[model samples]
Target: MSGTKPPSALSSVKITFLGTASAQPSSTRNHSSLALHLGGDVWLFDCGEATQHRLQKSSVKMGKIQKIFITHTHGDHIFGLLPLLASRLNGSGGTAEGVEDPRLHVSTGENTQPLEIYGPLGTRAYVRNGLMYTHTLLGAPYVVHELRFPTDPLGDFTTLPRNAAELPTGRNIDQIDGHWPDVFADNLVTVSAAPILHSVPCVGYVVNERPVPGKMDPKEYIPAIKRTKTPMSVMSRLQQGEDVELADGTILRGPPRRHGRKIVILGDTYDPSPIAPIAMDADILIHEATNAHLPGIDPTTKEEDTYETVEMKARSHGHSTPQMAGAFAKRIGTKRLFLNHFSARYAGDDDVNAETAEVMNAIGSLAAGEYGGEVTCSRDLMSIDIQLPK
Candidate 1:
């Protein structure tokens, strides 16, 4: 059996929930957004309204954000994208060659690389039009990539006005299983997306970390090398899984590699089971629980409000209850489940009232009933460190 390892271990990954509200924003909760801090870079899941403002309140650094992934083009899911991109531009003494507008003087000199943005169909048009209408000057370059399904409406890509700084591209989603092709890949992690059931074309992401090398004890190998009068360079070869032949004619084998952690984050969806194949055995699953049935503890629940009725209502609105989140987690064999994207009717974790605590507890309980693993009701600015097996 594996145990929870600390963040200091190899390939540390942490998840910070910036906003947890469904469609509406309360005083305590913002819209739907989360940040994944992977090593030096931060990858954003969704950027809703006031997402940049929420980032200021959290520990995540805005400058470290390298990529932004949008689940859908809903207002609650992507309204803040333009503002966030504009914020990245800083004033650097310069102006456009053909135009002399002061607002267009912002420079991308400080930016090291172009920020990559990925989303469903229409994301390219949305970002391009938003920037064009607002006359927003980006200090850095940005590229938008759209994942289109067969059912999505087609657009004339050649007709759209093009800007040199904004590089837009589109690709078709896999027809066989509704999987997205060429999502993203880096030295540390590989990200993939799959279409889920929703009113709009929404996607659920699976982030799989690259396998890390096993720990090698210096005490075990250093002393042995000294006694054999072997060069220290042999240790590097052995650590790379090479059988090193020392002066003593003894072969030293490297430790076995350790499997990396997997994380699944879904957008607002009534059913997300389509992503089960890629999300199997995830270390943590973050699923939306827009509405739930708390029975006696719920203030909004009436005598007629039963589990079946509540679930049906939630599904009708293209949302999910806590039970549905739990069932999906169980199906994917997730070790831990975090419920997010709560309805505006429920008080948030910041609320000091008793009802707030009871509602949060009830949400966790509902999910735990279906999934035997640990369950937590996520709140705005909540940061969770992903633990690894021993």
Candidate 2:
């Protein structure tokens, strides 16, 4: 059990889609809630309506989720936050003894961790409102950290006073670098952000972590666990970041493990130039594609929609069509592209599959045709294990 090394590549993370619906929740598409599976804990990005219900259906450890990262404060995205947090807090504190990773279904035999939430504006008010009502057993009290955009007329994600009236506080948690600049740098990952044309202040996030190379010198732990009978729980802490100590206080220091950085959900934006670093030759880019540019009516001829699609027509209202999302991904030189946050106009309708395929093909073609990247659509509960390019 002594002198054991750990695996490189930060824990394998999976983005589980609880719901990918836009505003309206349907039988097919719920609102937007994607679980970022970081081995033990789950980080939820944008908990749309009924995201908690979706969590029950998926293998995502809802109890492990306390942190949430919301893209914007749209009703569709924030409404579910109340119920999901309440249910997770009230129903289950930890996980059941059964729950394995199908990487999809929650199995019982394996070990899992708790959850946390992070997001942009209104997160504090939003979380506070939810907690105010529910009876949650949050020893950590499901922390909430609000990230505001800075400098521009919009909100500031960085550079704010602790005493500012509008400023929000982190729950139970002590330190957090919500500063958009430090979002990736401190993690040793390069991250960037900028404002987009949303109704209110909406910003996008891009992250790229450094990759781990070769294995290290700690492969001898299997025998140690058997010999010393150190609980896997205690051992995992040692591996993750903490030191292991015996009843008599024998300290086993955990060294830094190697891990590769990844680009995450490139989320909804009326625009996309700000998050290039996250897309910087990213192996994957998950951008929103709520518009598909169907052409029965000529845009030039139609005076109203001279500029079609969600991005163009609904510029400041916060939405993007397939073409704009694709072009943005292409411009960022993202190696892979995923389309999510599609409008209700195309969810579970059999007739729309052909249309969906056509839109997918068109957007993929547009991105590949221009940006020279691979493209695909994001399905609910689909787990995509990102592989770094060779």
Which candidate has the top score in TM-score?
1
Best by lDDT: 1
How high is the lDDT of residue 91 in model 1? 21
Clashes of each: 1, 30
Q: Cα lDDT of model 2 overall?
A: 0.59
- What's the CA error at residue 59 for candidate 1, in Å? 1.1
Tens digits of per-residue lDDT for model 1 on 1-390?
Answer: 123321222356899999999999998789999999888789999999999999999999999999999999899999988888888644233356775655453333544367888888777888878777766656567777777777776663335585446643434344456686448876667889888889888989999886665678867788778989988987765564456667778777766557688899999899997888889999999999999988778767889888999999999999999889999999999999999999998767644767788889888888989887899988899898997655
Q: What is the Å distance of residue 176 in model 2 from its true position?
A: 14
Off by over 4 Å in 1: 1-11, 91-112, 153-158, 168-177, 233-237, 350-353
How far residue 106's Cα lies from its native spot in candidate 2, in Å, is 27
